[model samples]
Target: MLSRRSVAVATMFLGIIYLAFISLGIPDSLLGSAWPVIRPDMGASFGFAGILSMVVAGGTIVSSLVSGSLVQRLGTGKITLISCCLTAGALLGFSMAPSIFWLVLLAIPLGLGGGAIDAALNHYVAENYKAHHMNWLHCFWGVGATLGPIIMSFYMVKHNSWRDGYTAVSMIQFTLAIVLLVTLPLWKRIAVSREHERLDSMIPQDQVGPELKQPAISSKANVLQIKGVKQTLIAFLFYCGVESTVGLWGTSYLVGARNMTAETAAGWISLYYGGITMGRLITGFITLKINNRVLIRCGQIIAIAGGGMLLLPLPQLFLVGLILIGLGLAPIYPGLLHETPTRFGRDNSAKLMGYQMAVAYTGTTFLPPLFGLLAAQTTIHAFPFIVIAFIILMMMSAEKVNHILNNQTKSTGINC
Candidate 1:
């Protein structure tokens, strides 16, 4: 059993990690929620937002691809602190940017910081925490996501100031970064305690030192050759495609298709993220009763139904559809993350987490821009159909992964 002091240290460290995640999420929705006003202010075309988004996503893809190595060298605490500072700087730069060019450049660091934080914390939580804790950790992320738009909406409604929104969030990031620095020693203490505890038998025997670094299982290429890895990566791709596309374009769709004011649209978008927050909170409890696969399948079905509702002409359906979609999407990402150590081995989970997140960011990078082109050629009405396509692809890929893992289990009498 852990000593009371060890338990206290672990709990404190986990709390710090959770706060870092909030910092990770604050900037995510800022651009999307403020884009309508921003477009008019900068005299940019509607589709230009996608270009900006693509730049950010590209940076994230690069960062995520390399995060495994970076984390091994620097440790999660240092990585997280450095990433937060980068994002804080980038966000502050965004608030002062005079043109779209400057905004595009600033987005690079923002994405890099975000991707590192995401990969590091996700791998950490998946390895150390239970299924419910994973769900709740992501629920806090939902809190930040939900707050982003609300913050933007408040500024837009009251002050007509998108810059102020970005500035406020940047301040929040900076403050969290400071908190992370002060508590850096706690991460080390907890890691050492847990390493000594060997809390789970599944923890790789190869882990060394308080940092918990281990040599790679094999080349990335070899890891990809594992059964179900490709399917899992594909599922991640389309899942993030659906999510990023929604956040990047949902406000535009609200204004262009459904004829809502920017402020109002921002508020409604917050409700969408609010659904995500509440859904994940509930799903944390639900995971005690249901396994990850069932929750994932159920979420996909509900999301598909929500996409159908989005295709309807009635404005009344828009909010309902958005909420449904948000709730539906809540479980899948965290569920998949929590499943990684079991699906692969704990030894491989860190490396796989990086690749999985890289592919996920690849989806974020390309899919929204593709839809932007589609919307530019035709109408924003294509948004729902595009979302439906991504969700269906994601669902099929996830099911295939399940089948592959199931077959492996049956054939070998071992969990894949």
Candidate 2:
């Protein structure tokens, strides 16, 4: 039996996992900050930078699939351990790479580890933790993401070297890896409980003993086969596109097109991420009363408004717009994830999340490169329009999804 204290300890361990991988965002945040330093050091072109991000994104998509399989084979606890080590190794490699090609090569492990950590942790949290816990779990991700750039920016200002900043962040990840390893025993206990629950759920309820009434057989089937899975996946994909496109490209647009200073651009970027953090925290509370579909639709509108603000000529209003955008996007990811197991059943939650993440990472991988290519050709100002287009598509898809889910609820007489 897993004690409440044990579960709390496991939650802390998972929070450390979020902290570990969330630090990965530091590299990206540093890219803009260190552009001048790194470009001269590595002789990188804009196309090369785009390719590097593309490589990471591509690797993440593939690795998400691989990690999903690993989780199935090794279990979430073991997979998380492997992922932590891989992430540590990748960051260490990235910190020391002498050339851009070497850095790009290192991106493979980084993606694998990052994607694995994300999928496994998300699965664990969704399975072991309650619904409110899911919100706070993702909130930690937001916190780590927000801290990444700040840490990088602080180190860059102090050391005047991007390498040092990366190396420091690498150390932090290494420390997290050690912490995760130390907590492995407790995780194993939780895993056993989860598996037992799974076994119990698979047996017929009438045949089940009183102790096994609450079974854990969360089905691992693809969302398409499940009644509500298809609609959830569709909403999830569009949400991923909108969230990633904006997160990756917004800073570039501010600096390159609007000609803002590095400091101002960084502050704006902070606002964008901070808004996400705030939204997640608030949504964690508000979700108790509100339907997720309603929350998601409201988020879509807010994202559209934020994108619109950036598209306009008012530079002064950009920060206000970004906050709205962040707030809007904040709920979509966690909402969709929380709804997944509920819609599809818990047996296959990890696999479903893996596929969901793979497709979503695919969006993150491709769309950013497309935005970069567009910026290279026309102007960074055009990037917001791309975001707008995606947001519109996401909203339409979400509306359709809401309709489908509602009809399914009526047909099956399921409350969700």
- Off by more than 4 A, model 2: 1-11, 14-18, 24-32, 153-160, 191-223, 227-231, 248-266, 308-319, 372-385, 413-416
lDDT of 1 by residue, 1-416 (tens): 57998788788788877887777777887887799999999999997887887788888888888888888788878988999999999999989999988998999999899998899899888877678778889898877876888998998888889999899899999999899899888766776666667654445533433222222233344578877889999999999899889987999999998999999997887788777789989999999888888899999999999999998878788679998999999999999999987787776777789899999888877888789999999999889999999999999999998887666655653322
TM-scores, each model vs. reference:
0.83, 0.82
lDDT of each: 0.85, 0.72
Model 1 ranges with Cα > 4 A deviation: 33-48, 96-101, 149-165, 195-221, 248-269, 309-319, 375-384, 414-416
Model 2 worst lDDT window (10 residues): 209-218
Tell me the tens digit of each residue's lDDT in model 2 across 1-416.
45698667666765665665465455445555555677778888855766766777777778787665688788887787777677678767866889998988987887777788787778777776555656666777776665666776776788777777778777877777777778777676776676775566565656744322332333544445765556556666667776777777777778888888877887887788788888988988887777566677888889999888887788777668888989999888877777666555676677888887887887766666677777889877787788888888877776776665556554643333
The TM-score obtained by model 1 is 0.83
Q: Against the true structure, candidate 2 has what lDDT?
A: 0.72
Clash pairs detected, candidate 1: none
What is the Å distance of residue 306 in model 2 from its true position? 3.1
